[model samples]
Target chain A: MATFHFELVSPEKLLFSGEVDAVVAPGAEGVFTVLKDHAPVMTVLKPGVVEIDAAGNKEKLFVRGGFADVGLGGFTILAEYAIPVAELDAAKLDADIKNASEDVADAKGDEARRIAAEKLAQLQELKTALAL
Target chain B: MPSLKDLRNRISSVKATQKITKAMQMVAAAKLRRAQAAAEAARPYAERIEKVLANLAGGVSTGAPVLLSGNGRDETHLLVVATAERGLCGAFNSSIVRLAREHIQRLQGQGKTVKILCVGKKGYDQLRRNYEKNIIELVELRGVRQIGFDQGDAIGRKVIDLFERGEFDVATLFFSRFKSVIQQFPTALQLIPAQISANENEAAAGGALATYEYEPGQDEILATLLPRNISVQIFRALLENAASEQGARMSAMDNATRNAGDMIKKQTTLYNRSRQAIITKELIEIISGAEAL
Candidate 1:
């Protein structure tokens, strides 16, 4: 398998930068994967997991609210919040889902309600995917 | 002319002050190390985002987002002044405020209405004396132990909401840029209608020059990215300000400690001289009384 450079960046610091075989990211439209020599593309990211396969080892990280860009420089993900799945706390996830549900119920405007609902859905989806 | 008791008190007070200043200097030095590391770590993300923005901005020539292109009016100005929450940092807060003052004066001179958005308690305290009416909001981070992206995001959201409401025609952010431990530069960056550096565009374009396919569309990506860019810029400013604050405080406390030491030494010398003079006078008196007897 061919490899390309991949970088995962957060506001506080750069999390990961290395040559990777494949990166599967959750895009706003849908989930997509990037491989070596992939065409240049830019997409917004939602709350979900980012799976990285590098040199036969696999890593999964949860990201929320950011963008992914694949260019001549390779692939880069600017995540608003990112943490390894292994380090995630199940109790915190449940609390977040509960809060998000309340926000959805209390939202007044149509746009606000829609955004809150979307957030709730994403959190629920993540909970099921992680099975925690 | 003073008593030995007074001299002793003065010397002791000076020595106590020196101890405090020395402790502060050490604390500042330790904090500066961590702050500098954080500022350096955040650089790559900022640079990468800028590059990505440059690429996207260069591709879109017409129908650009309102954030990339202004509202076509420059009558009103919003200044976002960011300063350290605490004082005792030599001239760090004052310099930023001074720069902001000059900007306000210049804008008012142009027959333009100016609004102030102060980010720290120090800045708000200084600016409110004269421009109290002009200040729209004061965002205090006094309770925060460390600056994070969420703080910046909150400020950015407020600015965007104001812009959307037609509160100001232009928005500028003021902060102290950390060059080194000994040097910090006060800088002003235009936030609304984002300023994309010319060199960045050339550098980004030089690399790929390949057209990018936007997932949804160019407009949608830009609409989201530009807003995020604002938050990123604010986060960078806050981090730089943190490093600069620690640097300034360290140097200031170092000077204070040295001055206190000098004062203590002078007071000790005065005390010794006074005590010796008193002893010599008493011995002379006793000798004179013996001769008379």
Candidate 2:
């Protein structure tokens, strides 16, 4: 079996770094997985869950938005916000959803409203996904 | 002449101050380690973003992105001065403020209108003295334990919004760059109408020959990358300021402790000498009295 390096970095700290069996990221277009010898690719990520499998152990994380870089060396996701699935609290998510909705309602123009709505939609999707 | 009681009180007060400064120094030392590590850890992201920017720099048409090409004038300027929230850090805040003051003066001399956006309370307090009217916004991180990207992003968004509104044609960020525990120098970085240094451009051009490709057209990526770059720059500044603040506080407190030690030694010697003088005077008076009897 072959392993590839993976790193998930947020603004506050480096979240995860190790040799992983595979990494599945929620890219803007779709969910994509990376393995050993994966082609170099760079893409922006959407708000969703990222699944990582290493040595028969599975870990999942919720990411707000960010970019993923797949290079010859390894794979890295520069996440805007990332939290482990286990640590995700419903109360905080609810607060975030309320804030996003307020942002949408309080937006001054079309551009601002659209951006806020997108954020709200993402939060809603995350909530629905978590319910399952 | 002062009473012995007064001298003793002053000595005790100085000792109390010394203890406070000593504790602060230790706390600053611990915070410095974490701040320094965070600043160092963020370097890779900064570099990566820069490389991507360099790659896409050539593709963007001149004056396409307002961030990259400016709003066609440099008459109005915005100085984003970042400093520590607290004041025990010796000259750290003052140095950054001084640099910004000079820069503002130069711009004003050139007949440019300058607006100030203070990121920290200390900077706001200092700049408010002279340029109070010119200050547009004050973003204080007083209660925040650690500087995060969200704060940086908010600041960046505010700057961008101001620029979009034609409030300022040029924006410069002022902060203290952390070099070491005892060394931090104030640096001014141009933010609006982002300028790429000659060296960075050359290195980026060299790296362009590599097999990296941008998904979608290069212009599309650059459009989004430029604004995100602003946030990254602001985040870097905040982190650097955090480290510099801790470093400055640590050294400043260290000096305070040492000065208190010196003062204590001098006061103790003076007190002992005065007591000895009083004792000699009393003994001589008693002997003279006995002879008269």
Across residues A1-132, which tens digit of lDDT does each residue of candidate 1 receive? 999999999999899999999999999899999999999999989889999999989999988768999988799999988889888888878877897899899876898799789989998998998899
Give DockQ: model 2. Answer: 0.41
- Model 2's CAPRI class is acceptable
Could you tell me the TM-score of candidate 1? Answer: 0.95
| lDDT (tens digit, per residue) of candidate 1 on B1-293 | 87899889888888888899899999999999999998998998999889888888877789998898999999999999999999999999999999999999999999999999999999999999999999999999999988888899889988988998899989999999999878999999999989996755695657663568898887888898998899999999999999999999999999999999888888888888888999999999999999999
Q: What CA RMSD would you report for each candidate? A: 1.9, 2.4
Q: TM-scores across all candidates?
A: 0.95, 0.92
Error of 1 at B263 (Å): 0.6
Itemize residue pairs with steric clashes in candidate 2: none
Error of 1 at A113 (Å): 4.9
Question: Which regions of candidate 1 are displaced past 4 Å?
Answer: A95-116, B200-209
Q: What is the TM-score of chain A alone in each candidate?
A: 0.90, 0.90
List, residue by residue over A12-51, the lDDT tens digit for candidate 2.
6778899999999988777899999887676777788899
